[model samples]
Target: MYEDFGEILINGGNRGLGLGFVKQLLSQAPQKIFATYRSAETAKELLELATNNPRVLIPILADSTCEEDVSNVAKMVSQETNKLDLVINCVGYLHNAEHGPEKSLRQINANQLLESAKMNALPTLLLAKYFQKLLKHDQPSVFSAISA
Candidate 1:
């Protein structure tokens, strides 16, 4: 099934899980791998990988939570190919230095919850909305979204 895959998109390629997917998928020899990262500072590894494999890998700078960024990414991908064989969304927000994991109901702050939703939940929906056209081929396609 993977051998026939022509194009693939990975949303959170800077993270370990997403980067692993990109590395493994390279074996399949897909025509293009569109990997999105929020910031250049955090995406050094991904940028390096892209530098090594320029023809196969394309690193895009995009903030998944922003609708405009997502839309622009879709447009950019469309310029390369009309169809995407697989899309893996690994952008998840569990906790940061300021906000740790909630241990109990009382620990669940409203703002943190909203921030979690924005990071963990919203990106996948927005990606689906904008990239649906690229995923609508006659062949089998997959869109997998990982959560926090």
Candidate 2:
């Protein structure tokens, strides 16, 4: 499917499944791919890919949970490419070093719940809101999200 990918955006592409998607997409020979990461320190592999494939792979530092950041990323992309062929929201947070899912009803915390929702649920809407301008309204422009 990515054989014809002109310009693609993959949110949270620093690690895990997102990382896999980035690698696989590269193998599929996409024209240009924008991969977002929250920190450079944790994005060594992604950075390496960006460095090796300078003309095709671009690693962007962005926090998907932040609306302003998302908007800024879209602006940056607009500077490079006027249209986006695909957008895949791979952002999700079920657990981290400081927290994990509640094993029981009593273990849930307000902050954790909000954090999960912000990362997992809001990215698709926010990306769409800010990047719709970069999409081709008259042609095939795909927007998608992955959940587990």
How many angstroms is residue 104 displaced in model 1 relative to the true structure, after the best TM-score fit? 1.6
Report how far off residue 140 is in candidate 1 (Å). Answer: 0.4
What candidate 2 gets wrong by more than 4 Å, as runs, is none
Model 1 misses residue 65 by how many Å? 0.6
Q: Return the lDDT, model 1, position 62.
A: 96
lDDT top scorer:
1
Q: What is the per-residue lDDT of model 2 for residues 10-127, given as tens digits with 9 covering 90 to 100?
A: 9989888889989999999888999999999989999999999998998889988889999899988988898998988888867888887789989889988888788788888899
Return the lDDT, model 2, position 50.
Answer: 94
CA displacement after TM-score superposition, residue 78 of candidate 1 (Å): 0.2
Superposed on all Cα atoms, model 1 deviates from the true structure by an RMSD in Å of 1.2
lDDT of 1 by residue, 1-148 (tens): 7776789999999868999988888878889999999989989999999999988999999999999999999999999999999999999867988999999998989998999999999899999999899899899999989776
Off by over 4 Å in 1: none
Query: Which candidate number would show the highest TM-score if scored against the true structure?
Result: 1
Report residue 24 deviation for candidate 1 (angstroms). 0.8
lDDT for model 2: 0.88
